[model samples]
Target: MPPMVVLSFLDAPVVTGPARGLIHLARALPPEVRLHVAILRGRGAGPVPPLDEMSDGALTVHEIQERGPYDPSILARAVAIAWRTGARVVQSHSYKPHLIAMAVRAARRVPWVGHHHGWTAENDKVKRYHRIDAWSLPRADRVVAVAQSARDIVVHEGVRPDRVVVIPNAVDARDLSTPMTREEARAKLGIPEGEFVAAVVGRLSHEKGQDLALRALAQARAQGAQVTFALAGDGPDRAMLEALSRELDLGLAVRFLGHQKLVGVVYKACDMLVMPSRSEAMPNALLEAMTLGLPVVATRVGGVPEVADDGEMAWIVEPESVESLARAVVDCVARPEERARRVAQARSRAAERHDPARRAERYLDLYSALGVR
Candidate 1:
C-alpha cells in the first residue's frame, strides 16, 4: 500500500503559531503518512529559514515564490504541486491558504481541509482577510477548528456544524524540556536573581491585550507585588505598548524581549506565564507553558478554559479587566505552594491529553474518514 500523501499550504513569512503547529503535527504523524508543506513567499519579504530546516528534515517543503500578495499564478503553482505530489488531501492553515485550497479543489477533485486557528482582527486589512476566510471555509469538505469557540465562529459563518470538528492545539512535551535550570536561564536573559518574573509569550497585539497586561502589571506593582514582566513577542502594538509601559512609569520592571527565537529559554527564565489575551483560540503559548511546567495565569476567553481549569491547572481571570488580571497576578505571586501544585497538574494534563503524537493520530483518523487511504 502506498503512503497517504497530504499536501498542506501556509502563507507564513516567518514561523508563526500555525506554522509551528503544522511542523509538530508532521513530525508526530505515522510513517505511513507523507506530509508535504508549501510556503508562499511574497516579494520583498525578509529571509525566512527553510521550513525543512525548521522541521529538521521531517517534511518535504516547497517554497512558492510569489510576485506579490495578489499574484494570480499562485493558484496554478499550488495546483501543480498538489498534482506532482499526488496529494490525497489538501489542507490549508490560514486565510490565503484557505483561498488557495479552494482553488486547488476546483482544479483537482481532492479532499480539502480548512484549519481555522481563529481570527485576530488587529486592523481593517486583517478583518477583510477574515471575512474572505469565512466566505471560503464552508466550501471545505472538513473544517478543523483549534477550539470549540473557533468551531462556533465558523458554524456562525455558515459552515455546517457536522462538517466542523474541534481539535485542540497540542505540544510535544519532550521538545519543551529545557536542560537549563531556572537560575541559568535568568542569568542568560539578565533577569536579576530572586526576582519573581512573569513572561507573556505571544505577539504584542491589541487582541493579545499587551496594553491590558501593562495596566495589570502597574496595578500589581502598586499592590506591593515585586514581579518583573518579560514580553517575548513583537507585533503591530509594540510602539503603543512600549509607550504605555513608560507612561505607567513601569521603568525597568518590564522587559520587551521582542520575539525570542529560542522561546524555551524565555519560558525557563520566568517564574510564571501570563496570557492576558482579550480573545484566543487555544493559544500555543498556553500549551507550551503547561508542558514546560510554568504556572499559568490566563484570561477566560475562547478555548482557554477548555485547556486549563481555573485553580486546578491555571489561575483563570476575566478578559479585558485590569483589576481582575492584577489581582490574579498578585495572588499567584503570593502563593508559591499553589503554583507548584498547579504546575504539576498542568504538566501532567498537557502530557496526557495534548500530546503531539495523540494529536497526529486524531488527524490521521480525520484523513481516513475523508477517504484518504
Candidate 2:
C-alpha cells in the first residue's frame, strides 16, 4: 500500500484517548507501512509535541492552523497535503476531520475511512456538531466504530451496515511494564496508604459521569467502605463536580488530580478503577487498567461489556444508577480473592484481545480490500 494520511484534531496539552490510540496504532504498524499525520490545530491551542518525538521519527507530521469550523482554506490545505504525500487512503478521526476527508476524497479520488469515536452531546452546541457528523459518516468509503454499540448507533443514524466496522481500542502493556509499587505510587501522589483507592480517569464532563461516581462514593462510604476516590483529568465540569463533592461532605475522602500526564502512576496508586460513564465507546482507560492488572467496576454502556464481562473479568454495573454503582464498589472492596481472580483474567484478556499490533494488522486487511496495494 502507498502512504496513508491520518487527519485528526489535537489541541489539548495532555494526550487524549483517541490521540494516544493513534500513536499506539502507528507504532505497532509494520516498518513497511508509511503513515503521515495531519493535525488541524485551533488558534492559541496548547503546545503539541512533534509526532516524530513520540513515534521515533517514523511518522511525518503536518500542522494546519484552523481559523474556524467552516474555514474554506482548511480544506485546500488538507487536500494539498494529500496530493503532496500521495496518500492512497485518508483516515480521519472525529467529526471535522470526517468532513475534510470527504472533501479530500472528492478532489483526489482517495479512499476515506471515517473513525467514529462516540459523540459527546454535552451541550446544545455539541449536539449540533454531532448532527453534522451523522450527516457526513454515510458518505465515507468505510466507517470504523470503536465498539459494536457505537456501530449500531451510526447505523441507526444512516450509515450502511456493511460499510461500518467494529475495532476496539488497543493498549500497549509495555507502557506500564515497570509501574511503581503501590506504596511508592501512593507516596508520590500524597494518597493515604491505608485507604483503598478507586480511580475514575477521564474528562470532567456530564457525559463522563464523574458526578455519578461521586454520588456512589458517598453511598459506599456511608455503608462503611474504607475507599478513597481519586478523580483524574480536567474538563469544563471540574468546578461543578468539585462543588458537588464538597456538598456531599466528602472531605479528605476524595482527591482531584487535574490532567495527569503520568496516568500510569495514578493506576499504580489505586486498588481499582471505576468507569462511571453515562456513555462511552471502548474506553482506553478500561483497557489500560485491565492491562495493568487493576480490577474495574464499570457501568454497562457502549463497548464496555464487549471488553469485560460482569463477574468474569471486571465488575459491571448499570449506567446512571448510583445504588448499583455503589453496591458494586462496596462488593468489590469486600471481596479480596474475587478481585484478584478477576484482575488476573482481565490482564490476560487485555494482552490477547486488545494488542495494538493485532489491530493494525486488521486495518491493513481493510486497506487491501479498498484496493490499496
Candidate 3:
C-alpha cells in the first residue's frame, strides 16, 4: 500500500496543544502503515527530529516553507510530495490543508480526508477561512471532526451528515500515568506546599476564557477559597490577561508558565484542572488531565459535556460566568472526597474513549473505508 499523507500546515511550531495531539496520533499509527507528515515552516516549526527517534522508521516529515496567505505554491508542493510518495490517502488537518487537498483531488483523484479540530471565527480573517473550508469540504472523501460539536458546525455548513465523522482526540496513556504524587510534582515546580492549585492549560486568549479563570480565581480567593490559578500556555492576549490579573489584585495568586513542553508534569503538580474556555471542541488538555486521573472543573461548552458526561466525571459550570466558575472552584477545593470520586470516574472514561492506539486503529479503519489497503 502507498504511504498515507498527513498534512499539518500550522502557522507556528509544534508547541501548541493541537500540535502535540497530532504528534501523538502520528506516533501511534501501526508500523505497517508508513506515514508522511507535511508541515508548514514557521517559528518553532521544522523537521521533526523526534519523529525519527520515536516512530521506529514509520514516519517522514516534510517542511514546506511557504510564507504567504492564500499561496497556491504551498498546495503545489503538497501535491508534488503526495504524488512523489504515491500516497493512497491524503489527510488534511486544517483549512489550509483542506484547501490544498481539494486542489490535489482535482489533479490526482487521490482519496482525501479533511480533519477539523475546531472552528472559531474570532475575526474577519478567520471568517474568510471558514468560508473557504465550507467551499472545499464537499470535495473530501471524508470529513473528520474531533468532536460532535465540530461535526454539527460542518453539517450546518451544508455538507452531508454522512460525510462527517466524529473522532475524539486521544492521549498517550503512558506518560500521563507516570507515578508522581501531587506533592512531589509541586516541589519540583516550586509551588508552595498545601496551597490549592487550579491550572488552566491553554493559550491565553479571550476565546479560551483565561480571563474568566482569573476572575473566578479572584472571586474564590475573596471567598477564602485559598486557591491559586496557574496558566500553562501563552498567546497574543498574555499582556491583556496580566493586566486584568493586576487590576483584580490577584498578586501572587496567578502564575503564567508560558508554553509548557512537559504538560503532564504541570497536570501532576496541580490539585485540579480548570478549563474556562468560552468555546471549544474536545480540548486535548482536558482529556490528558482526565486520563491522568486529575479532578476537573470545566465550563459546559462544546464537547465538554460529552467528555464530562453531564457532571459525572467533572464539575461542570456555565461558560463566561465568573460566579458559577468561582462556585465550582471553591466547591472542588473544599470537597476532597467528591473530587477523588470524580477523578476515578474520569480515568475510567478517558481510558475507554481516548486511548492513543485505539484512536490510531480508528483512523486505520477510516483509511480502509477510503479504499486504501
- All models: lDDT? 0.89, 0.86, 0.79
- Candidate 2, residues 333-361, lDDT tens digits: the string is 99999999999999989989999988998
lDDT of 3: 0.79
Name the candidate, 2 or 3, with the larger lDDT value: 2
Q: Candidate 1: which stretches are off by over 4 Å? A: none
**What TM-score does each of the candidates earn?**
0.97, 0.95, 0.92
Residue 343, candidate 2: alpha-carbon lDDT: 94
lDDT-based ranking: 1, 2, 3
- Error in Å for residue 84 of model 2: 1.5
Model 3 agreement with the true structure over 80-149: per-residue lDDT tens digits: 8877877777777667777777777777787888877777756788888878888878667899888899
Model 3: residues with Cα > 4 Å off, grouped in runs:
1-12, 42-57, 175-184
Residue 125, candidate 3: alpha-carbon lDDT: 81
* Model 1 agreement with the true structure over 263-370: per-residue lDDT tens digits: 898988988999999889889899999988889999999999988999999999999999999999999999999999999999998988888888898898898888
